[model samples]
Target: MKTLTIRRPDDWHLHLRDGAVLEGVIADTSRHFARAIIMPNLVPPVVTAQDAVAYRDRILTALPQGDRFQPLMTLYLTEGTDPDDVAAAKESGLITAVKLYPAGATTNSHGGVRDIDKAMPVLERMAEIGLPLCVHGEVTTPEVDIFDREAVFIETVLDPLRNRLPELKVTMEHVTTKDGVDYIMGSSGNLAGTITTHHLIINRNAILVGGIRPHYYCLPVAKRENHRLALRAAAASGDKRFFLGTDSAPHVDPLKECGCGCAGIYTSPNTMSCLAHVFEEENALDKLEAFTSLNGPAWYGMAPNEETMTLVRQEQPVSYPSKRDTGAGAITVFDPMFPLHWQVVE
Candidate 1:
């Protein structure tokens, strides 16, 4: 068995939902990551600098004792968002970026920007202050098929946005298609993207392979095997433009298993282990550290974490925890299908 050690990794994107669910899930993230860009799409949404501060405090309060995990916050971009508020949040150092979710694109994104045109002033303000705009890149037209949303969004939305605001830094969050991979690659140094664990490990077939595996279902849903191959190549390419972000969103079991299932995968507890499996299988284990630790901070203009962690290539069966206990109740956990073989050494 081989042993590898590298700088402590940060999850550039994650969802640590509020209160009980947060309490139950924070430890899983803290155990594996030193910091995470916390999504602000709560029930009411964190739209202002003040809201972001309060939300950050709630995330801190929810973490287990002695955990040094830092929750990097983001402001939810809405049609009526004030430019001054965006600047104020960035100046306060509480927010690292602004999240743009096309209205109706994903979970709790109904408050997201309905028309990107309406938010030009906000995006401009962010560009001025060096705040990157993290986008949930998917078109929500009723006529567009689910799997085609990402590619369509790039052509119809992102490309136009880039042409319009050439100075603005954009991160195409959880990119799932070959077109997405090409867009980021074609953009070179300016625009970047975050790849998720589930997207790298599973394809759309995982959803129906064994009779509708609800846990494998996620928004910006997984695509065909060829797309998965493209993602694998990009992540393993050691390209600084690509980096790690678990998008470890947790939903209650009942909500996920219901008729209209929720969209997210809860992999915070096992993200690193899973990535190690994928990278190792690709024979790119040597480049894992750059993708998992270095690329993200470089893209964000922050330094890599000073601390280090180790993982050993040992075969081990990891049980899937169906639910994480919190003050309220157990919040359901997503199943990553197979047992993980790598173990992180603290």
Candidate 2:
């Protein structure tokens, strides 16, 4: 098993922020992932089809020359979203799904849907049109403990929504709990989940144990060891319900190192290598293609990539840069806190 080749993978979830940050990180993702569900949680948010198209165009403009990558755009689902506009976006083939971020859930989510009821017309339309809703599955109430948000979201939000709209397709993005895994597994065909590379590797300990390692911190804040094990098991299980979504969020070093740090891990540069090591460790390398390449496209009703990527296991450790320079500022790369030996050779 010195070398592993699979269909080029797609990131079911990703965040390529606009402007200088977008320019700095787009290539890192395009180098390995063939396509990604581009997140819509920018400053103003891409809340309409026209916004998604413009954002997609900007992404293309920023894409490194000679890199073949597709940006799968999504619209932010605000309370006032126009169903006709949404349906038209889908028909026009410029948008792939709609995103719902509970207001104040994460970065730039202030415009997110506050009342699920208010957004139902849009959700119902999505269900009718067979469009998937990508939800940031966390409750933003002040009383809930940070670690409990994902579980609470499942019990209080997602379950009820699914029961209410059985026909709507949904992806619980960057799921971080055993409860989430169980919920998705116990569900019918309309539901699926994407596991992040960092989530599968780190837990609360990584963020709080030694010191406050801000870089290791992320939304749906990584849970306890048991939850991390659950995520790893789900990903390596070869189940179609689970797939890769790096959630490779990038923030400048200043923002992350300051008093109030942002939540995200910049892992696009090393995700495939880390995943290769993880799958190999689980002795489930045979199923890596399913988790990384095959399952996401299947969920989205698309053909798997014709292009292929080969990862070779070098005897020596692979060295990835600790930080990437965005010119605007430096963005720290995710340190898995373990040596990686696998490299994407082609």
Candidate 3:
């Protein structure tokens, strides 16, 4: 199919870091996605309804003039989070979901939940109110090898939590392993996963095979090639349980290039193009809309976007900027390691 049209996609997960970084990168996503479940892991994190609102306002202010994009706010889940405030945020429609970072799971997550028991009050409240909890589904214990974290998290953390509160809706953000895909596919309800653009395209080899490629490194780091295939199959299967969450995390060049580099891949700029290439390769291009546009909103209890975007495949390879200059520094855009032929018609 040379030309395809679908509803403007919504990113089930995104990170528009606060301040200058946010200002610089907001447009990259806003250009394609209609809405996004904006991640709350800022410098201090958005842990309260007021914080979500303030952060949402900042996102809106940062949006390039005339860009019609919605930032679905979320609270950073902390042990001390007030149930009443979360419920109020829901009632007022100020926040979309609550985020769970297992303290030190990823960047700015040192403030995350250390003990699940300590967070029961908030989690239980969220269950009662039918609010979603987007989890960074990985165990942080030191003994577990980095590549094994996602599978271990499924066995030790996620399964027990789901059994304990079947009513709670949880999005296993950035499912990098087949274990994650199978876990979500086997679930009956209230469990879904978001597949990232880079995970669908690259594996652990992208990071370590040819020296250290910092930009390819991300939390719950890419797994084996077979896992990437599982993710690809799940995404292109038209399964309601899996959808797009670019997880387009941006880290400045210096932070990524240093000895103790950060974990993230910035894919916002060329996500749609990369996705189109993937779906086309899978011979499942017809299912692209379901994965990118329809499933996420339905899972989040909203209607799919009415607006549509058309992608036209051209003979010539499309070119995207390798670096995005933010006020913070130059952030590297994800290199898919292949030429993209699909272009979103402006």
Task: Pull out the clashing pairs in model 1.
Answer: none
Per-residue lDDT of candidate 1, residues 246-293 (tens digit): 899988777788899989988887788889888988999888999999
**1 or 3, greater by lDDT:** 3
Per-residue lDDT of candidate 3, residues 100-159 (tens digit): 999999999999999999999999999999999999998999999999999999999999
Least accurate stretch of 10 residues (summed lDDT) in model 3? 207-216
Whichever of 1 and 2 has more TM-score, that candidate is 2
> CA lDDT of each candidate?
0.89, 0.94, 0.94
For candidate 1, the TM-score is 0.97
The TM-scores of all predictions, comma-separated, are: 0.97, 0.99, 0.99
Model 2 per-residue lDDT tens digits across residues 56-175:
999999999999999999999999999999999999998999999999999899999889999999999999999999999999999999999999999999999999999999999999
RMSD to the true structure for each prediction, in A, is: 1.3, 0.6, 0.7
Where is the poorest 10-residue window by lDDT in model 1? 328-337
